[model samples]
Target: MTSQAITPSHGLYREALPKGCIVFSSSEGRAIFREALEAGHMRCYFKMAEQFSTQTELTFCGLTTLVMILNALKVDPGKTWKKPWRWYDDNMLYNCVSMPMIKEIGISFDQFVSLVMLNSLIIKSERVDELASIETFRDHVTRLSRQDDHFIALSYSRKSLGQTGDGHFSPVGGYHPDRDLVLVMDTARFKYPPHWVPLTAIWEAMKPVDETTGKSFQTEIRIKRTQYFK
Candidate 1:
C-alpha cells in the first residue's frame, strides 16, 4: 500500500480509497480482516458488524458513530422504542446533545463524553494531544480492537486523512498487527466504505483542532455496559 497523498472525500460515496488504504468491501481488505479474525484480533469486529448502520443525516456522524458502538456493546437505552425491547437509536441518543444541535454540526469530544456517560455507558476518551504520544493512541486502539467487551470510535479532522468536509467520527473494526493497519468502519455509509489505514496515519489525523468543538480531536471507547434483556 503506497501512501498516495490525495484529497479524499469525508463521505467519499463513490470516491476511491487512497493508495495505501484498503477498502473493506474489496477482497484484499476482507482477507486482511479475515486473517485477523482467526488470530483472535477481530472479536469486536463481529459485534460491530451486527449493528453497523449508515448515518441518517449528512452531519450526524457523531450520532451515527455512537449508535453503532452503543448497540455493538449491547447497552439497552432503558426505554422501549417499539415495545418489549430497549435498544439505542440515534434519536434516543440526543439526551445530552439535542438532535437539532447535532444536525447543525457534529458534536465535540466533551459533548460526546457527556452523552455517553449520561446514558450510563462507561467510556475512556483521550485526545491526541493529551496522550503520552501518538504511540500511546496506537497502543490503546490496538488493545481495544482485539477485545469483545469494548469498542473504539475516533473524532478527527477529516482533512487530516486527506478527506473532505471537516471533523468526523467512526468506529475501529479491528487491527492488523503485522501491517500496523486499523480498520475504520465509517458510519457515513453514503460517502465512504470501511477501509484499512495505517495506525500512525489515524493518530496524526486525530491531532488537528476541531474548529467546531474548539479542542483537539480524540478517540473514545465504550467500556462494556449493562447486559441487555428483552
Candidate 2:
C-alpha cells in the first residue's frame, strides 16, 4: 500500500466515535500522540491527525516515516507472522496499519510479499545461491509446482532479501502454487517482529458462473489471515 495525505475528516474524525480523546485532549496526551504517530503505529498516526484535525501539522518527514512503516506492514508475510514459527503454533497478524493510501506507496518488499500472501504462492529468488543447499530449496519449489494450480518465477532481483548465514540472499524470484512456504535462503534472518500485517489471500480471485446468463463475474475472496496459514 502507498501512503497518501490524510485530512482530519479522513484521519481521526473518520472514525465513527471520538478518537484520541484520551491521547490528545491534554498537553501530555498530545505529546505522547505526536511521538506515537511518528513511531508509525498505523492507528496512532491517524489518531494524531484526528487529534490535531490538521494535515498541515504532519510534516513530510513524519509522513515519509509513516509511509515506509505502513508499506512494510502491507507486505512482508514474515512480519505478519505468517511464516511457520514452529510446527504446532498458529499464524498471527504481524503489525497494525491505519494509513489510507498507504498501499499505493511503492515498496519492494510489499510488492513481493503482496504477490505471495494474496496469491497463496511462495516466491523464491535465484540469488539464494549463497546458501549451501539452495538447490534443495529450488527443488522444493519445483516439486510444489506439481500440485500448485498457479505459480510464477522471475530471473532478476527486484530487491534483496538481505544476507543469510552463508551470504547475501540475492533476489531471483519464484513462486509456488497455493503455499506459504517460501524456500529461498538469505544471509539476514528476518524473524517475527511486533506489528500488524494485512492478511491478503488469493481466494479473492475466485469467481463463479452465472447459470442464467452462462457467464461469470469475479467473486471477492475475503478469508481471515488465520485460515490459510493455520
State the lDDT of candidate 1 residue by residue for 1-230, as single tens digits: 88987876774336666677788879998899888777767878888999999889888787888888788777778799778878877777777767788788767778788887787677776666553476667677767777877878877777878876768888888898888888898987777788998888887887888876677777554455654311
Model 2 misplaced regions, further than 4 Å: 1-106, 118-129, 150-152, 158-230
Please give each candidate's TM-score.
0.87, 0.20
lDDT of 2 by residue, 141-192 (tens): 3443232222222211211211111111111112322322222211111221
lDDT of 1 at 139: 73
Distance (Å) between predicted and true CA of 20, model 1?
A: 2.3
Number of clashing residue pairs, candidate 2: 26
Off by over 4 Å in 1: 1-13, 220-222, 226-230
